[model samples]
Target chain A: MRNSIITILKKELKRVFLDRKLAFAVFIMPGLTIAIIYSLMGGMIEKLDDDAHEHITVVQTINMPHDFRLAAEALYGTGMIIEENEPTEKDKAVQKVISGDSDVLLVFDENFIGDNREGLPGVTRYANSIKDFSIRGGYMADSVLESMRKNILSERLGGVDEATVFTINREDVAKTEEKAGKAISMLLPMLLTVFLFAGAMQVGMDTIAGEKERGTIATMLLTPVKRSHIAIGKMLSLAIVSLASCLSSLAGVLISLPFSNTMFGGGFNFSDLAYGVSDFLLLIVQMVAMALSFVSIICLISALAKNIKEAGGYIAPAYMVILVMSMSTMFMQPEGVWSYMLPIYGNILSIKNILMFKYTHTSGLISLASTILFASVLAWLMVRAFYSERIMKSS
Target chain B: MIEVKNISKTFKLSKKQRTLDGTKNKFKIAVENITFKAKPGEIYGLLGPNGAGKTTVLRCIATLIKPDKGSIIVDGSSVLEDSREVRSKLCLLTNELKVDPNFTAEYLFGFFGRLYGMNDSEILKRKKILFEEFGIDEFADVKTSDMSSGMKQKLSIAISLVHDPKVIIFDEPTNGLDVITARAVTDYLKKLRGEGKTVIISTHIMTVAEKLCDRIGLIIEGGIAAEGTLNELLEKTGAADLDDAFFSIYKKTRENVS
Candidate 1:
């Protein structure tokens, strides 16, 4: 490292770390805020799920067979209450369901007669689809009736063994590690990219544009140090700082995982991810490269802007573009060698492949190389801006 | 010694700037054919009004901005081709340039000194001398934002001189300073000049120009209207003092520019 570059880098680090309030806002608050929000959101969603599960529904039945009560009890579980059929008119019974007074209306055709042995009788179920209680009641009613019919068919065939021609069994053969990888691969890559970009932006705008606005940059520009060194120094310091923020937010996500398990269907522990040290190391390396690209882009934008507000305006669209790219990874699979050369999108896909245990060295190399090339170009542009007129414009 | 040779700079104006400045032209000529020399052990002052291209010329000489044409040489180094070497030889103090507000005086001094490639002992020695002279020792550890404006200005001067360069350039040296602080700053410039340093400053104050400067260049409308000693200016303009001489020159220069 050049001595001037080291001096500049040290000063940049000192500017952030020496102020306790700024350090906390830049480093800890982003992650802490994310954890609190995720936990709160997870709690709300879990509560909704629990409520829908536990609510008992009221069922109104017309001419329901008495012989089916035992079958219904065995199949429907405890969330439904079957009302005694009080000889109510059919129209009135349906009106009860429509008015939301009753959860479901079960109408047995006249031919059912408790002895559909002569002719198969139809059962019509009516319930509002929009209401959670009505929807559950409708499902329960269908399941109970279906169970009774199957039982009757079995009895008529003289034995359940003779009733079934063949059995179809279903099982998941995927390992727990594969299951976890599948679960996290859907979300983690996009989340990581967004978090890392946010971390980069938090300090990057102030590093250059803020200095220009305050006229502090011209003071530094008067120094004998090379302008390229100043640009690199600010960029390196931002990468390190933003990476710290990204790690903090990652920790927050990890901490919130247990609380959010209900939303993801609680099951195996984190050990199920089953990543080795090499896997973790590769992931970190890819993420660090991604951070470099983010820092380079942010520095370039800041260098072009006259003040922090203008820098923010220019940066917000870039953030949205990256966000859309990362989000596109959710619905996509790593396709080919060409896909790994598409800048930020490629890096995210590569990260997704790593988590899903689908990464190849060729894919990783292409992604890393493309990112470094892109970031190098941006870093070079930032240095040029420092050397030219754009950086000195103050409005 | 510092020599500014036929430097010219023009700024492209944005729509907003054009409207604010009330000019239809797309470019504003900041400095044109500006040339001067400041020798060791002498004070050379650029006497001009606010928009007379004083700061622009100084900025070009400081290597902060490149001129559209021509060059500046500071201690035998070209500002354009050898900017880093030129910057190493000269120091600029201006109201528009400032240290970071978040930094303490002591830290900034050390930071800039290190940027100049000074060892800690050399920085400490300069700090001891400069801080004491500027009364900055009392608030050396205080953040620039928390300090008074006078204190901040003084610290800016001290930090600019951390390398103890051969050429000293100040723009509006007494701007935003109290009388006492201004006097202290002027006295320090004199001491620096006495130590065989080349000192150039831009000011509109006739009294400061008359008393502080060994020679004066009257700049008007991006051009040097006249250049002479105070006595020479008085004699040439047929005026009794620098104030009368300046107005006589200003009227003639404005007529010529129009």
Candidate 2:
């Protein structure tokens, strides 16, 4: 059985990797696509971070309170090179925010300082756009007003401690570097799912459908080998190719780890993220199961299709369904029994859970087993189709 | 040796129009109770027109398709019970000549040799013999897509016979070949027969059938109209040659229908 599968795998690999165009699709193009995507993402993130930290021109209107001005200078002094401009009216300031001349505008009401003992009326914050800086300015303005109110209360209480009057404690909830590494790890399963599905479909569809289209399959059918052997051989070959594609894509993803950390602000240690021996074995099993399921589905479609064009038409919907399922793992938590029972959905969800360090061994194993079972049934259907008189007669 | 016994096949076409619902369409009989045998060292020809089921019969004998009725036996092994065993004993040369453009002739030869369960050394030995025999030794390393149709056809035939199956089935072997290539193919088939292998060939060309087939089966409308030696068929139809004899049998059948 091992020998037969190896033979089939060799043939499949030859079919995919040896064909210059197919080789490009399987190996080179995918890596290039990953690199391009990562670069674009990294560039966008850098641009956004730069915009957040860069200096901005502010036109203060309505005579900002002394305390508010001091607060603004202190906040903007860190990285923002704030430039003061002539005071503009509130409506004009709003208009200026739209014209892109100023990155932010702060307006204080005329009786703002006089009402320092009490809460002040609303302060209008504006910008050419509602950008991150403008939002940060609003927060800064609110903090300044709150500090003035606390001072006024302390004065009224004759030097009593401000802690009894009011207090606010802020705790940082941002993920640490280790937790951030874990967060990025959540994408591993999704990447694996997408690559495996894509590889299997690409290779499997070509194996059966392309052969049929080229008229080589009919000649092959004339061989004395059992139809089952051919089906197994082709499936095994597709699985190997699919696995290689998945591994290559993984490598591409890993290569961009530093960029991913820089873009997303994480300190992910590559060594920490490496799979152990047992985990690696489990990953292989899961990937094989996924690859087999995909190959089985494609082979069945190929058997049903009259030619490669027809096979492609059939495969489009299958791809859409699997794509949607893979993406769904991103939005939902895989805790329910249903998520562990569906084929591609279950497998992807289980893999996602595993990558996130969620204890989902049972679910993952079940998903793997069910996918293999489904693939087996589909493989049988393909074998039966091969044995059918109609297919041979049509040929 | 290969035996096809009383095999029949029918295909049902689904109605295309909704308005024709509930109306029963006739089932098309591709092969009806057709039977023949090929002994070792003999070339058996199945002569027929288009849609006469010659290829279908050959496919059945190759065990590519299961017959709706009856059975086929290759070297005393049942096609249904032991298809793999039967397959190991035969090689099928189909009409369509397609080769993977990526693989060189030598690679494909080695690949198919291994597929037939030939060991590494055996495959290498067979590859050498086939490349030399087909005079494609120089071009063995050239990609198949770069080869001409004649070269591709030669490679296809060589690949089929690489394992030296006892039974060889060739369906319209010279369908698209030029005169020289066609002559080369027919000469090769003659050589195969001479080497004590059972050869079953399906063709419409009467001259090629007459020159090559030791015995011929004339198939019409999915059934064998007659089967005999060249002289026997000529004498039976009271005609001078195979073509005249074929026309006489066809004319008699058409007249009987009228």
The RMSD of every model to the true structure, in order and in angstroms, is 2.4, 3.9
Task: Compute the lDDT of residue A217 as modeled in candidate 2.
Answer: 72
Question: What is candidate 1's lDDT per residue for A1-395, written digit by digit as tens?
Answer: 29888888888888888889988987788878878888888798888778877887788887778755776778755767787575557788878888889889888776464554666677788898878778888988888887787777788899887777689999999888888887888888988899899988988999998998888998888889889999999999998888888898888888888777654445657778888898888899889999999999999999998899999999999999999999989887766789999887788988998898888899999999999999999999899999885456451
- The true-versus-predicted C-alpha distance at residue B243 of model 1, in Å, is 2.0
User: What is the overall TM-score of model 1 with all chains considered together?
Assistant: 0.94
Q: Looking at model 2, give its docking quality level.
A: medium
- Which candidate tops DockQ? 1
What TM-score does prediction 2 earn?
0.87
Task: For each candidate, report its DockQ versus the true two-chain complex.
Answer: 0.76, 0.53
Task: Please report, as a residue range, the 10-residue window in candidate 2 chain A with the lowest summed lDDT.
Answer: A77-86
Quote the lDDT for A289 in model 2.
84
List runs of model 1 lying over 4 Å from the truth: A84-101, A112-124, A155-158, A161-163, A263-265
Cand 2, B chain, TM: 0.93
Docking category of candidate 1: medium
**CA error at residue A195 for candidate 2, angstroms:** 1.7
